[model samples]
Target: MKPSFTFSSNSIRLSYVSWICIFIVLLITISLLPIIWRGLEDFNPSDDYRLPYELSYDYWMFSCWCKYACSNYPIVMIGDSVVWGQYVGLKETLPYYLNELEKTNQNYPLCANLGVDGIHPSAMLGLIKYYGKSISNKHVILHLNLLWMSSKKHDLSDTEEFRFNHPRLVPQFYPKIPSYKAKFPQRANIIVERYVPFSSWVSHLRLNYYENMDIGNWTMQYPYRNPFNAITFQIPYPEDKPHSEPISWIERGMTKQDFPWVSIDESFQWDSFKKVIKLLQSRKNKVFVIIGPFNPYILTDESLNRYKAMKKDMENWLKNEGISYVSPSDLPNEFYADASHPLKVGYEMIAKELVETESFKNWLDK
Candidate 1:
């Protein structure tokens, strides 16, 4: 009956506590300003774990060379990372390179890069759809991944990702080979990549590596990591192995032919492929279907059997269509970035093909 605290006193206590919380938060935020900045700058929609293919600046630089060397024509390169070269800046990537190349080569055409890594079944068509209207002599090159046609046995999803020197990943892209680190050291490097954010310490030091001496006032450098050296992985060219993936999986009974009890997915990836082509054609743009290199694991014994069945379906559909395609098997593995990806050498080979193709000739005339 004698203990009634006034409302004004309680209100004062609450206000004081609220002010203290705000002050503490302000202090913490100020103290961690650098950490916050690093997190913000390095934000990647994808896993960003780090994979070899993702971090291979050398390969990406080569793609730029191809673009710079062939910038005279209306050149458009469309595909996934095989086209994007994610780790490098856009200017340092293939498209930028093409622009530079066109300036130097009177005979070369203006080239464009419309590639997005981890974009398999949908985005390729987007490249042609967007770039088809922007310039003259619309020429587009596509890198087709046959594995996209493989069975759901991979069990990878749009969000899953496998490891590489860095995590070669995409948002809603592909599934990771769980335990990839335990299995592939080079592949699992993202597990412990020394993420030394841009600091005054790094800036004060002179770190420059050169590849060519053609930059005029500014030298052309092929910047490489100190400990993050690149390792070459063997990618199987089409001519190298007709059915590598199947063979590898066959050992695990992925093949249904020998057992004669296989149940196929009854799905043909090319059906959607036709829709993509039509989308590009409707926009009055020509589509250049670039085929990517197939790895030995992609075309094995079981895969051969599957291809035999699928070939007829593809050819029948192509009877009344005009498409442009090229295979790395037509070239050599030295051009590939890894077992399944292409690098600088590969981009050069691709550039050479475009400059020499009949499709390119047609574009030149248009």
Candidate 2:
């Protein structure tokens, strides 16, 4: 005869409640851990500081940076890798040059670099909306890189799934991206992380300490190594040297090519950029735009003509919106690293032009 074991209804109910209580306690503990850990660190960022290149995808670190910048710096320069100084070092970036130019002036505001690599217009919108809550009532310099509009693929308009940078920062559900191929669970996880401090904190640990691997995989890779040993509590510094040699496009063997430019009226990236402007404005930010000194030396005549027209259309919109903007003249051919990014000397030239512009002066005064 087999012995039958069955739990009573009351016992079953009690066990269910106990499990729920355990979950609640675990959630609270995890959430509080990040707060406590962050408090223990004595993080004091210096001038010309930017997020470490390795931590570019760590939104938690970015959020903490945003709060710090909001508290200390009055001017924040936000954009893609152009603002991030892709072809140059941290001290050679646009924000650093801006700070240097302002240092001689009376009552000059300190500028902070809030740029992220590969963050196009769409991702920029999501980043500001979710992680930049502390960026209110400050002067924000937003860079517009027309390179994203030069092709459907870069603009995220191609009807194909391809990986792009900062996938978690883009819209997860509504207004789907054709190039993004994240599944439902992945998308859901990203959305949850944006709203959950603990998830992002865990991601920060994975990226900065665990060689960008999850605990399960990391443990498997180093079976005998203690996981806690990886947490050295030391933050990495931003790469001080350029990713590539600081040279002109021509020196790099880049020749003139025709770019299939998209119309501004139907461009997804342009639309997203406009939304970014509106978001900043809604937060009472004093927004100033910098239209690219996009290198015309790398464009075919026809492509250059199209680019000029597109630039004109963009200028017209800025004028109509009454937004302060500067479209500086192209730097010397040798100053450009590519069609968009500028070399160290190029950034210095651009900063000089910006500081001398009447519109820029007026915006800064305001």
TM-score against native, each model: 0.43, 0.93
Alpha carbon deviation, residue 247, candidate 1 (Å) = 23
Residue range 118-144, candidate 2, lDDT tens digits:
899999999999989889999999999
CA shift of 34, model 2, Å: 2.2
TM-score, candidate number 2: 0.93
What is candidate 1's lDDT per residue for 1-366, written digit by digit as tens? Answer: 776864454343448888899999886765575444333332222111112332232222222223332343355565556566533433444444545545576554355554545545433332223322342235555556655555432222223443322132211112333323334553343222212222211211111121212233122244433322321222111121111122222333432322111122333234435656676566565666655554444345766566546544554454447565544443352333333454444455555555567754564565
C-alpha lDDT of candidate 2 relative to the true structure:
0.89
Per model, how many backbone clashes are there?
A: 47, 0
lDDT of 2 at 60: 84
Angstrom error of the Cα, residue 128, model 2: value is 0.9
Distance from true location, Cα of 214 in model 1, Å: 44
